[model samples]
Target: MMPQTTEMADKLDVLDRGSDGEQRSQPDVTAQSSKVSPLDVLKTDLPAGLVVFLVALPLCLGIALASGAPLFSGLIAGIVGGLVIPLISRAPLSVSGPAAGLAAIVFTGISALGSFSVFALAVVIAGVMQLVLGVLRAGGIAHYFPSSVIKGMLTAIGVLLILKQLPHAIGLDVEEFGAMSFQVGKENTFSLIARALEVIQPGAAIISVGCVALLVFWDKVPALKKLTWLPGPLVAVLGGTLANELFQRNYQTVALQSEHLVRLPSTDGAGGLLGALHLPDWSAITRADVWTLAVTLAVVASLETLLNLEAVDRIDPWRRKSPPNREMLAQGMGNLTSGLLGGLPITSVVVRSSAGVNAGGRTKAVALFHGLFLMLAVLFMAPLLTRIPLACLAAILLTTGYKLAKPKLFSDMYRLGWSQFTPFMVTVLAIVLTDLLKGVAIGLAVGLAFVLRESMSRVYEVSREGQLVTIRLNKEAFFFSRGKLVSLFEELPRDTHVILDAEAAPFVDHDVADAIRDFQSSAGLRNIQVEVRGLKLAPVAPG
Candidate 1:
């Protein structure tokens, strides 16, 4: 991964210079990068799909249980996300399914509706809303979110995952298992952590610690990196499962228990796939709750799909950018189909997508293969797969969570300034306290507040020893700061000499233009002499 990052940078450097017309080197080693053929794509995709299948297996069951849905609903969603997306998607590689982020929402909805059928209805409505969003081509609205906020969101997700999984990773099942809290109810993460310190499940804890260490070491080991043909998660999950079995057999210690099992519904044959059907709530369409859920689902699912698409493309050796709008349509179709079949709503998942890419997946064929594997697993390996411990899944999630919440991620955000850190930290807190959507809303609100506050603060007067008063826009001025601009104009004393110097303004928004237009029209009323500098009058676009 480290070498790959450097390689990407070098590729970007060369790609940026195409316009220079400078004397170039020989026929392209890099141009060949774009020569990925149908056969090559298929070969890469099939193995990649298998890798995704392994990772997705545990996740599908876990997420379905977390969402208060039938276990098979998750698998159904996974199959649809993996199988149907290739038809409409422009994304070279993206594996979609039930998301951890949406679990809380599903839980809340199920609790309120009092039935999985009602929740499925909500999902269907959400799918329709997403289809409408695709028709409107509003998927690009995600671009309006600042890069800083997005980074903060990703970082927050990482921290939340770490906190949520820590208890499970360390073998402590408290009141809140998959929780993200410094504190919650009478006890929080720290309290449970304190308990973990006192009464460690010596056997389970040891296995988890060993699993984490092995995964970390495997990533750093060079020789093993070549054997990267086998994904790190795959090794860790399989190894942990086997280790649990050995521990039970040898030491009479079992970390693998019924509560921690991936329960597969009992069935005689392949017919079980057809037996695992969920019907939607036909009456839910008339309810306001369904409408609300539809909007939320569409928004969250679309955002996840777009972000995952971006991340997958970044990891692609070929660096192909996915079309966001087209991907949105595919997701809508996938969700619709899945919901119809009594399955959970599907979205592009980073976990399996990363697994697929790491396993040398080059095309959508990998996703299709994964779906095929998932369908076949029910017929062949259902009983065996059911034996895999939930602790093993926790280990995989723990490893993934650590990568998100690494120390460097925090340092990077802090270095970016308060404008970045405020949203970033708030996002973490929000995810911990509430759920994903509410957390994101709170963080976004903070970011917007930061913008507005900075805009207002730019109005402070500067003392210049001259007849002319130099009005300077502050370092962080945006269009939303126009009220400050207007207020400054209003506060200017009669007959004052003034210079409006916007050279210091890093950004000028439409409100600034409006304020300027208002000032120019009313300059005579104030009896103030004003001179402007660095005023680029290009009309600002409405966001």
Candidate 2:
């Protein structure tokens, strides 16, 4: 027999080769097939679902509060987003819910439409529009957005999260969490913070700071990393709840009131759940303003969904690319269901998706489980959920926000040079100053300007050796490049042999070709020799 070491080495070599062969054979397996067995779902997705449920609960309520809609409406949207959208979406890791980005739109739409029920009708109409958009394959528009702008959008959202959550973290809970727009009501983001400072609660402040500290420690300490089964956010919530109880019992002066905690509508049974579902006002269907709001919702919701889908796909460990059109169809169906149920409009949300991903969610089962958890909590655990403090949730979001807008992100963008950094900074500033869609538009415009400048600069190449000037045209010359071509002709040295080469160019615009012809015609007057080749000009139009 061989020596023990040699025998073990041989076995290892065989195992290594087998591993390599498996990897090579299944290179596309993750993208092509994302289905998980029930056993796998129970082991991995259940825990992930619980984590997402914890994150989604507070956000759902907060977004509804920010939108000026009934709190139950947000839960309805979250439920539908979790239950319906994942069934149709091709993205395995993406989670859908009520979006903070649409809070301002919903707030304004409700006022314009006269009632929440009427706004629900607009949401239904928007859902139909999304279905039409999916049918028309408009989801491909997401591919046109620049990477810089998308990164900026994510970073800006992070900054907004930190700013918005500060008040809640410090126990100054007047405005809701998740409002990203610079201005909300009589107070803007800064004004709200200023107001919160005037009535800050010391107990809430202590709890929030302690929760943040725990989260930071848990994230950094390797010893704590081993206890991954218990999510840090959940622990923070528990700690905050216990701390609040102690404060109420002992430090009565600084105790957090009921207003400072989650307040899910308590329901008795199936009847209560059914009774909570609100229906849209069918009479509002004929109103022109309803249609206008519907169109706006459809456009904005679709765009947000597509953007989040792209962002989530990029971060997915499997690197699977989602079909954008299918995602739109899923979101459309989800919105339709939500609107019919008196829920807020739904979109694929970055925060919930990020939480799911961080929790090791690998299949749509995670979303399904989270939805079930939401339903169960509303039905059974509403009282317990209410005990959790807003400060704890704020701490969780603070960590998330820090992840998104880390200082390294800015440094990385700067390293990419101004072409990337300019649009990124502009997008962040614009979103912070204005809103999401407008900010993205501004970034897109800036990105397009850079594209045009680059295109114009590369129209042609000019070289002169010993007075022999050669103007070699690029692959295509457009009207935008005509001025440069004309300038080149005028600047050529007198009596020099000038060669205008177009043989390499695939196509030349009519205006540019005309300019070239005029230059050739004028060369004789200047006593200059001109050689032209390979420019097949378009036939002149008859007058």
Candidate 3:
């Protein structure tokens, strides 16, 4: 292998520049690492924690409800992700908790496994799988995903968020979680809008609209955006909460109660938070259903984590990168701890991760602060949290979703070239029509097919100057290209000076080498003078 040149290293430094808006020399998000002061990390982490907490609070409950798990289980995951994972994680800024990606798996596990205890067994096993994957250094697979496809996936999720949460924001409830197609009661965005107009829950709708408007205005208004310390989402949620509180106080509008409230699990006291921790049931581990669900959870959770990690790194204000394998280990530990304590499955979340970065969080310490805040909220302000309206939570998610599927997202992907655009577009459509995993599967299949097509068409261009014939093979020189080499040799004119240059080729398969040697022997009869070049430049023989 060639040693990295000084120029290359300088180029890399330029790519890693913080807040400099320079293009990175390498596109791989996980390949680089950097350093920071402990105090700076702590300072940034505190506000990041607050922002993530605000974003994560509603998501935890919604994902738990979607997954058919007890609502408290979601909080358990959030707490574990915030408090436990940060302590163990190699990546400082990332926040972990109940993942939206695992909702389908959780739904299946509870329905088939028959009990939450059985499902807990699966969560534990999935943790083990993730830990092993980290050990195997399989996180490199994330690098293979085309950037356009990732952008598409994130954007599509954003679009879906708007479609899914719009109903909730308008004070219309979907009996199921984020209704994919919108069939049951008041299904679809159109119907929800009509319902919002007809049976107007004036208080909830008014507050939600106000929250969205405030969020939009805050970002667009020059002076408000300058208030960097104040996070827009936090302000939106708080404003909505205050709106509901004031409306109820004067009897100007109907009080928003259980139907619209953010329900925190009722505990007798401070002890209730501790008592909520669930332990794994050993007997449940023996069931085959447990193993199946565990595998499912691990696969889904890992995918979501990998995807979020990529997004977080992309949006990092510092342009700092995370080691994927190390991230896997941290998440694995988080899941293992959360499951043992009867929490939901956890993964890195984009919204919370973004909140951390935007809030000036420089390290994992901010995540810890967020967890502490959640614990305090549960212990001291549980009743206050109840007064917060679901619409407000809906508003937060709507903003998240909108950002994910923003129009500029599509435009950016389209400009990146077909290799990225096709798979990304496919991923977006597939996820919209199906679920996350299946959609990714379809995208991967398309991506793989493109790879294979490029592989098979690997070409070697040859130029004839007088009696000399010079050949330059593409990067890929392998057994698969043997037939092409043979055809090329057969077509070449005899009694010519020939040079085979494999220097540009990183690899030359054994079969290809054999084919080359055979071609040389055969050419001797035709009086063709043949020479191989570039092989000596490498430390060892080309593979």
Candidate 4:
């Protein structure tokens, strides 16, 4: 391959094979070496971890609030997810925590369970179920999804990040933080955009625009590219926060309020952190409702985690393949620990992982250090971190989203022909309009339909030699394929000898056999001769 083509091929491989990705995350959610150098951890992963931590902190709090759980629960899950899942998951870049996708589920689960502690018990049991799924090798299901659908899912996530965060960027729209589903309360994604336009904050808009501008040019400039360790997001958030302070001091009217900043429950004093945690109510285990919710949580969390895991691995810079089973195991442990520690249920978050990748993360320490940061934040830095404006963070995500759903990706998909492009776009639209899992299902169905049609076409091949026309059966020709085959048989030249062969077919549907027999019986009327091979239908009598 030529240099440019080779590079493009490598990028597609990264997008398809669970390796080499250039950039945002997906529900706004790779493979790589199982090993890392200590220096790499210190110089690369740690900085990326800080960047991810900055991204994750607000999300943790926001998701918990959206889920109607204690605000502290989101932080707990983030800390546990950051610290635990990385230790066990083979996916080096994935960062785990309270996810926006699960907020509605958690909300309903909590209402059904009657108490947060009871819901915590269900989360623990859900973890056990995930462990069982891992042991059963359920993660193998990851391989079945078509590459087009997967890419669509990733792209759809990018679109979601942009739509969901656009209002946040402008520091308007009335939805709670991390409430990013297509529908939230009374507002849908698009309606929120209209709302944002109606209520813009000048300071918040400035911060978002500045941060986005910085991110766009940060790597393009030679001077900025040299400081890879200094992630653009870290600077954006810190600077935005400082700018917010200056706004308050010098220009009060346009300054962002507390609602536009990171919101964490204070964890100061001697035992405030410990005081905030709520232990699971083990006594609730006997209720069928608890088990029911547990099963639901397990299935949902595992599915989301698996999908996110696949997406991350597909884009890993090192092109390393992560073990899906190990990811399940890690998620199980993470959820289990979170439930015990008074946290909401946990999953690998696409947004945080993608942000880390976009920021140049290279090791598992990205997760570990982020988790550690969460812990430190809870112990110490809540007030300072809270100073950071959501608009700046939104800018970072908007930049990431632009990378994932670039115009080039769509055009490239279109060039792959309908077989690929159809499903890819379907998946993207379904995901953007609906939720992640539903969108994937809709896309998978379309892709499979194409596969089935293609398979039917491959069931038989036709060839002609002089007066003989041979139709050779392949695979197992199904009843649904008989119509096409019979039509082809009818189109054969009237005076030619036609041979029906089934040597390659393992099984022929009865409908297909009858069609062949009917053709043989009538061929003489058209001066056509029929010969049968391998097919066991009795020879037709003279007409």
The TM-scores, one per candidate, come to 0.79, 0.87, 0.79, 0.87
Whole-model lDDT values for every prediction: 0.70, 0.82, 0.73, 0.84
Look at candidate 3 and tell me the lDDT of residue 201.
71
- The residue-level lDDT of candidate 1 at 104 comes to 72
Model 4 gets an lDDT of 0.84
**Model 3 agreement with the true structure over 198-277: per-residue lDDT tens digits:** 76677777877888888888867868754545667678878988888888888565556677777677786768766766
Report the lDDT of model 4 for residue 108.
Answer: 95
Model 1, position 312: C-alpha lDDT score: 60
The parts of candidate 2 lying over 4 Å away from their true place are: 1-40, 226-228, 266-268, 493-497, 506-511, 514-532, 539-543
Cα RMSDs, all models = 6.8, 6.0, 7.1, 5.5
lDDT of 4 by residue, 1-543 (tens): 113344444554443322223342220001233444576567677888999888888788878888999988998899999888888887877888998888888999999888999999998999989989988889878788899998998898889989989999998836766666787777799999998998888998999999998887886886875575788778888788889999999999999888888877876653988887788998998999999999999998988888888888766766557788988999999899999988999988788999998887887789999999988988888778878899998998898888778877887789889999999999999988888888989999999999889888899998999998998998898888889988998898879988888988999999999899998888889999988889899656675
Global CA lDDT of candidate 3, please?
A: 0.73
Error of 4 at 341 (Å): 2.0
Worst 10 residues of 3 by lDDT: 27-36
